[model samples]
Target chain A: MIYQTVIGLEVHLQLSTKTKAFCGCIIDFGRAPNTCVCPICLGFPGTLPVYNKEALNSAIKVALAFNCQIQEHTKFDRKNYFYPDLPKNYQISQYDLPLSRNGYLYIYRDNKPKRIGITRIHLEEDAGKLIHEDGQSLVDFNRAGIPLIEIVSEPDLFSPQEAFDYLTNLKSIIEYLDVSDCDMEKGSLRCDANISLRKAGSLELGVKTELKNMNSFKGVKDALSFEVGRQAELLDRGGDMVQETRLWDAEKGVTVSMRTKEGAKDYRYFPDPDLTRFHINQDMIERLRLKLPELPQEKLQRFMKEYSLSEYDAKILVSSKEDARFSEECIRIYPGKDKKLMVNWLIGPLLSEANSRKVKISELNITNDELISLIGFVERGEISGLSAKGVLSQMIDSGKSARELIIESNLLQVSDTEELSKIIESVILENTKSVDDFRSGKTNALMFLVGQVMKKSSGKANPKIVGQLLSRRLTDA
Target chain B: MAIDNETIRHVAHLARIDLQAKELERLHVQLHEILGFIDKISNLNIEDVLPASHILPISNVLREDIPHTSLTPERALENAPSKKGNFFSVPKIIE
Candidate 1:
């Protein structure tokens, strides 16, 4: 009895506007509790609510990027609920009509794009934070009234890894838009999944459970995997499915039922009286669409075609907007060089350095000009690839360019054919046994002789010339 | 379209308002009268008309994206029922 897994995600992204959604209060993530609040955000009497135009603009940019159709008339609604974190009894959100809908984000699977349907993207106000310590809970109102957009996806994902891929692509698109930071650790982006399991090839769907509180993208994948297995086992054992919301206990690594349908909250939604409707115009959408940057997928295809980069290298370079821009900058700065070399250094050594330092590649102290100059040294045969790595490490640490670092450290590669030949002759004479082995057709002995030449030259001699001169000297002998 | 006693009690419970039995009975009648008055509009054939959420003719009421000075922690927490330091304290939530 094989089963199929169906998944959909509702992601909440906090827009990085300077002010709160409906008020003029400052929006800061880690500020002191209750500090970033004003009368309007605090839900005080006589404080009329006004929408933030910047938030609406960011939402439109994201919606357009996801290929959603912006509704001509969108309005805010009040979702009534009782929670300690919500300063107001109701959260101003969208109901019946959202800002945008029917968008699709294409994720690459098996080198082809798979379009995932976006149900809607709506604007809402975030609740405050609740910190429970000892016996009581304390609420921080700083996050309250922050503008958030709920992106609901249709049940198009068939596997947990597909969901992970969808989220990665989605995050990349959002980062490219520059609307939100989308940092999961700081709670700027959060995801919850609705997953159900059905018999393989069956048209009917199983009763699904809504999974909440998955902290990371990997957590989402793992939680959905566990839920699929659990539901499949339950059906195999002839157990009835229960419609409920489950919490992902990350520590226990299991889905625990948070609430059943009996206690389920019915958020009685109604049009919020304080805020008016937003009539999106064609002029505004066209202006933003013109301003939209080249997306990751488009950039990826262009990188492969224009730069002649391998699909693997192009994909890695375009994974982050910063890295993609950095690669382009390097290519632009150092024209007439092998783009493959730049791609290799960026994907290999530069990326590893950034990873070790726990910073973004663009945030590395070295500039693109510095990196291109470093590659230029290698291109001109002034430094070996090995020596260039040493120079790059120092450059990252001390903010120095490649040329300065090479001079200061005297890492210039010794490519002089005369000097290398003299060292190679001495090595052939000193290692007569290896010379005898090379003459006896033990071809690997030539490498040992070349290693001796490099060691005698203090690793400054170019290995390529060293190998060539050593082979020439041995055969001549 | 008419309101019933059971429905009134359920709505009251959902709203977290505890109602006495006599109060529920009285409100049930009053709620039905209000519904009965409003139900007259249902008889009109207004299928082509759009449902209006707001009566105002204006739309797109929005403000600029700028931050003004926020209230101090003291002022923000001033009206809370209970406050501890800079936070609003509440009963421990188990779930």
Candidate 2:
């Protein structure tokens, strides 16, 4: 059956704050079990939670970066659930009055920007970790009460690929905001997806399943893809799907039914009476807005316009904040009218060098002066392109100037006409048979003589100059 | 507003209050009477008033995001009925 997939993702981003959301417990990961716990986070009776100012600021920064409309008035709610991980049995989260709403994130579709609606972003406290053992489960409260902003997206994604793109772009922007590290392996960024498959062109929506346990963005995409296939197969066999919560078994590469999804009524959400509402003022929003860095989209658009880079090239260059800065720094120092040369090296040899080193391009030890001088050698025909490549590797490795590497490696191209004339004279004397072959209409013999000059110079001789000089000397004499 | 017996049972279950049958019957009558008395406040004319989350006009009660020392694991787990090493042990929950 031809079906259209609808997906909405919920990302829980842990703010890189020093302390917990409602307490001053240090929020360090990989610590001793329950070492970071306190009365406020452990839910001791009569304990009151004080909101973290930095957490609120980080949450607002994320909302502003995504262009979400900040709520004038926002309050926390008690989301009641029966889970051992939740020490309080009720998670303090935002319900009706979230931090912000009605934002959108841009995902690339068919080489054009597609705006995926961001339903809302709310601030909440994370639950604890549960590790199961024989006949018992142990709970660690260290992770509890960490400030987490839940970014919920509208069901604008139509395919698994779009969902992947949405997450990738979302993570990029969040990193640029410097709110969270967006590290999935550290459990700093977690994702849950709700997907439904409806008959193609159907207006009415199909029953959706909420998928969880996706530790990485790729895990979410793969789970969604597998779910789509599972649902489509079931529907084709005339079987209906029930709305449920499923867990992604990344090892098995399949999503298994965990439990029935609870309704909003089961949660019984209510405004948290302990923490009072805060009026998010225009002054605060404007302040955070000023602090927002030039986001991925803004940087990409500017790169295309100012640097004359294609969208593909601009997107690649601006994907990482550091790489974009490195490219821009190189271009700014480049002594040329058209910066395409700088862009080419950035997206070409430099990128390959970075890839081979298993690091970002900016992470390479490439200074602007050295790199520009390296490229300048190739442009002025002073060094052969091959020699420049060798010099570039040395420059990146040694952190030395291009001139230093060139001189140290003896890679300076023999481009001087007078100097090359002497080599050509030697090549003509040594390879007289090839010279005779060339003058007698053996056109290929000219290349043989050029190779002799290159060999005599130990590969420092520029092929273009040697070719030109050898052919000119042979034909003119 | 008339409160139903089922709702009373649901609320008791949600609150984890395991009440006896006689206690449930008696409380159902008392709770309805209480709700009926409180529902009279709805008749007051307050159409011009804005909804308030808190009554004391208090807001923005917060603290700086500075890490402060808290109870050690030994102190934090002092009251736990069951402890496995430093963590609180409970019945194994697979899900």
Candidate 3:
């Protein structure tokens, strides 16, 4: 029987706040083991927690961006647990009343926007780090008490790719808003996935397995794929599925059982007495809603409709804020009838070079005007497209103009009809057999002659002019 | 409601506790009392009202892409229970 895989993701994003969630301690990562700790963060006796207003405001902004309905009154709850990483022995999170609910993020898959329902987006304090040594354990409080907002998605995803697309869209929106860095490698953005397999026509959900410890988005995809296969295999053999929480082993590329699933009462969740119930007023919500910039989806549509870019090109450009801004800056500097040329260069050579050097477009020495000038040189046929690549590298390295680099490197295209005619005549004389084949209706031979002319000119010849000249010469013979 | 001995034991095992037999009897009564109070929440008409997940109405908090200083090896290993040179030491498992 064909089975469908149901997937949902819980993404925990560390808010880009300057201080701890409920304390004034500076929220700095990579600090000394206990340096960032204070009475409030360390959970020392006789210390009372005072909530940071900035953290609350930041969480509000994220909730509004996701189009969640803001609650008039909300409070925090203490989740009881006995983990060494949790210094307080209980994490302050939302239980019955979260700040935001009923939100949806629209992700484009296969050229259509798929609305993925967001179950909830709640604010909580992050736990500490546990370093496991030889037969012993140690703790670091640097990340403790940091503010985290966990966004839970409804079980609307159908496949592993949809889950991946949902995550990519979520990351882009969050990064564009300057909320969290959303760097999965750095653990600022963590994800947990719940997957189940049921018959294709079934409406009820099957027993789901929760996957954790996925440090990257690829890990999430691989773990979900593995679980889907594992669950299907079990159902094929007529075996019962166990609902459990599993940890993703990235190296082995499999999900291992961690523990049986627990319900809400297992955590002993209760309203946190140390914190007060806060209210979000209409003015505050309106102000934040107005402050929200054009999100990634809107920007992507504009790139497609207004700029006339391909879906693939627009998606790549709008994936990251830096790349999107860089492309927009290039467009603004070099407005023309053919905008696709600028889009191609921005997505192709520029992105390839940036990836190779492991640097962002902003980090490159090439400015918008330099890129515009480089593309302009190619558009005007002053330099061939192949020669413009060399010019771009030179511009990035030496910070020179495309025009200056063309002159300094002697890369002017052989658009001089007189000079190109000499190279074409030499090619025709040497490759007499190819010329004969061209006359005999071997159309590919004509392209070979054009290539020979381009090779003779060191890729500095205009391909269109060479083709036209070669065809004209072949016909005359 | 009557508290059952088997239900209390299952709850303790689910919570990963090694509760003694005597403690199970006491927990049976306490859990019954707690569930009775929680039953009050089910009585409210929360079907139409949306479930609240977060307390604040915020979205899209982000940080600048600036490379802050990273923890040095010394600071990273300062809290390690065992260390060998610059690396954290772990128990050997392979032969």
The window of 10 residues in a row where model 2 chain B has the poorest summed lDDT is: B51-60
Model 2 per-residue lDDT tens digits across residues A333-370? 99988799889888999999999998989999887777
Winning model by DockQ: 1
**Model 3: CA > 4 A from native:** A259-265, A355-365, A397-404, A416-450, A462-477, B1-95
Interface RMSD values for the candidates, listed in order? 0.9, 0.8, 8.9
Of 1 and 2, the candidate ranking higher by TM-score: 1
iRMS of candidate 3, Å: 8.9
Error of 2 at A141 (Å): 2.1
Per-candidate Cα lDDT values, in order, are 0.90, 0.91, 0.82
- For model 1, the DockQ equals 0.84
Return the TM-score for candidate 2, rounded to 2 decimals: 0.90
On DockQ, the stronger of 1 and 2 is 1
Alpha carbon lDDT of residue A389, candidate 1? 89
User: Residues A1-477, candidate 1, lDDT per residue (tens digit)?
Assistant: 799999999999999999999999998776877889888888888889999999999999999999999999999999988888887889999998999999999888888888999999999999989999878899988999999999999999999999999999999999998989899878999999999999899988789999999889999999999999999999999999998899999999999998644866778999988889889999999998998999999999999999999888899889889988988898777666577877888888998999999987888998988888898888888888888888898999999878888999888989999978888878877999998999899999988888898899888889888887777776776
True contacts kept of 3: 0.02
When summed lDDT is taken over every stretch of 10 residues in candidate 3 chain A, the lowest stretch is A258-267
Clashes of 2: 0
TM-score per prediction, in order, is: 0.96, 0.90, 0.81
